[model samples]
Target chain A: MIKLQLPLTEADVRQLKVGDEVALSGIMVTGRDEAHTWLINDKPDNVRKLLEGSVIYHCGPVVSKTDGEWKFVAAGPTTSIREEPIQADVVKEYKLRGVIGKGGMGPKTLAGLKEFGAVYLHAIGGAATLLAKSVKKVTDVIKLEEFGVPEAMWILEVEDFPAVVTMDSHGNSLHTKIKADSDKIAKELIGN
Target chain B: MAFKLNKEKFRDAVLELIRLTSTELPRDVIAAMEKARDNEEPGSAAKSVLGSMLKNVVMAKADSTPICQDTGTNIHFVTIPEGISLRKVEQAIIEATQQATAEAYLRPNAVDSLTGKNTGDNTGVMAPYIHFEEWDDPAIKLQLALKGGGCENVSTQYKLPDTSLKAGRNLEGVYKCIIDAINKAQGLGCAPGVIGVGVGGDRATGMIMAKKQLFRKMGDSNPVQQLDDLEQKLLVDLNKLGIGPLGFGGKTTVLGVKIGAVHRLPASFFVSIAYMCWADRHHEMLFTESEVSYD
Candidate 1:
């Protein structure tokens, strides 16, 4: 039931810990597999300027054009582990304070969250259509004609977006904790 | 003998099916998720997570949008009449996929596996690999599925030697293998999901059958009595693992267990398990000549 806002400052991100409930509000950038590669390998200019103090959502949205106006139909969080190799670097390079995605990122991203003041938020996986309602507006879109909708970087204004602090600046990760516990149960079942 | 299909009509049908399936979370899945939420007696944390998930599905349906941002990579299986022309069907699928992807505003999920290039259309060479089976029936059936990477990654196959099993593919063995997969996958496959099991075939055939079997409606029992009994037993055992909703820990880790089996030689047994997350977005359609006139 804890309430919060987005475009989190370095101090704000640092104060949060794993297991904190949050309702994010502010401008968050949407990026997924292709967009992550473009950021790390291509190093698109002004990417830092665009992301500084902003939240990055690992999502690709379903959108349509009606009478020349683009509207989102559904947007849901993609798995963050797919971006594990590049997430920490992307966070550090862009000075990002928050990332929103489903499942959880791996150790490197967790380490990066600790080194840099950042937090990883878990959105409900498979709730794309419902999650899109949080988006108030799309300010601008980049790389659309080239990368298409899912791969393109969509800059959106969202209000009170819900998420949980699955990973925090202190290197705590809910995913890791759960996995370790599940593995213990698994091994016992195997009589190992 | 040429079977003709109206390309536009076929395409529109596919698009509408995708839209319907994407927005409306299937009834069985909703019931499963809700049951999981209520049965999560260990703690309120997991219950709350499942509750939010239920709410999310309802909201997405009301809004006519995708329930997940990862709309998923389109995978289809087409069974066409022997005399039907497949060219039109194939083209319709690709064209319909592009249009639906654009209209549904699906995320560009198709990437070149080797080069990592994004195919904006969500189709490339063999991208939407259509497994075509020539059936004696006059009608064509298309099974459409959006295979999200999260669940796709958790699919597993075990090449079992014929001599290793004392009971000739017993339920215990299948149960153990499934538990092994879930344990290995952990929360990676976005658990509290369905497991599609394909048993007694070659490696490739078993895998394909596993994927295809997911198209079956949730909660439907297997036609084979032994397999049905095994499915029920495994469903109970899997839930006991307490992987809970999204692996946060609780009851109800799996919504259902589906088994598709084919006869195999006495020398080998191949078991393939494919996990489909709660998103489990899929639909089925039957197209007959009587439904619409073909040019």
Candidate 2:
């Protein structure tokens, strides 16, 4: 498996292709529906630097606190399709080198990845407790009060988080290919 | 003498049920996943995903952490004796739900429709949705299932004779509809999942029956031979799609296909499917003779 550090370079992301399993170690940010809307609508300048060459995860983690320090209990990828509308802009404006999520994104996000030299990573959906072990620490969090726990942005430090690149900078999407292939097989199996 | 319910005892028992349901994967589900894992070619994405899922299941139980981050909606199917009060059971369940959220057995999932505010306590309208049934036995039975949002989104209803697919209002039509749902689901519903199909009722009842089928153990067979045959055939056909785990493509697309039928009006034929992900967490508890047992 390929090991990736946070704040990856364009060249680093471009080298990856669809179906390459990777272990990511470094900093990442978690965002969901409300956080995505906030990013595109508010156009916040604060996170721009943090997002540059970094990945945004589509996750709503179950977190806890002990001795005044926060920790993750369960953190798994949510469906990425929900962020399709705003994902392209997030990638382009943020100069993000990678997007880590599950299920995969739509055509717009694929175009964004190709244009911006980024890759879309698919974290295993439903493998929460196993994946949470990769998170080394919880550095910070934002929008906890307004958007609640699930929608808040969680900035984290991770080590060896596992994912597969289902969409690459080369414009290959496993989701699209699988959908088309499955559809044709489905039709034949049904038989008109 | 009138039977009196012990509200506190029931509430505490419900909390434990919630905890076990959230943190543990059912044995039948785990066995199916292991079988899928063994069938996949080594070094394939499908095998890797199944491996992770199995490991995660073990870890969740060991640490008593949630199996999945979503924690999902809490659905309760309550069966009680005639003398029991629905209000009392619902109140106990609600209190248990609140306690579960605080203890991290569930994430506060209920959000206000307009305001988009989290209830913080996992209680509100339709929270921990309850369905009631009357049973002759003196024991009380409660079944809880934690359904994740991604899988729930893919669950759907279909009205036949869909001209587009040329599906008729028969078992054949039901098969076609289920195939379509599985293909469309592709890895979004977390493939290598469970497919629950309900035929014959109105739109609402069809869906209700579909979800009810989920409580059945994965290994159990429908007593109806026709439905059982369909279940077996569909399982094979779906795996052929090669959607694999999370759509990475390989073997083992689905673990099981369960179908239930209900009588409907002559004019309407609706087929409802409730898709469940591999992290299927469902368990039942029984209370009788002042003692409780869980499965």
Q: Tell me each candidate's TM-score.
A: 0.89, 0.98
Evaluated on chain B only, what are the TM-scores of all the candidate structures, in order? 0.89, 0.98
lDDT of 1 by residue, A33-119 (tens): 778888999888877787988888987777777877777777777777889999999999888898888878888999998998899
Instruction: Give candidate 2 misplaced runs (Cα > 4 Å).
Output: B1-3
Model 1 CAPRI quality:
medium
Give the clash count for each candidate.
10, 0
Q: Which candidate is the best by TM-score?
A: 2
The weakest ten consecutive residues by lDDT in model 1 chain B span B161-170
The top-ranked prediction according to DockQ is: 2
**Considering only N, C-alpha and C atoms within 3 Å, which residue pairs clash in candidate 2?**
none
Interface RMSD of 1: 3.0
Q: Which 10 residues in a row give candidate 2 chain B its minimum summed lDDT?
A: B1-10
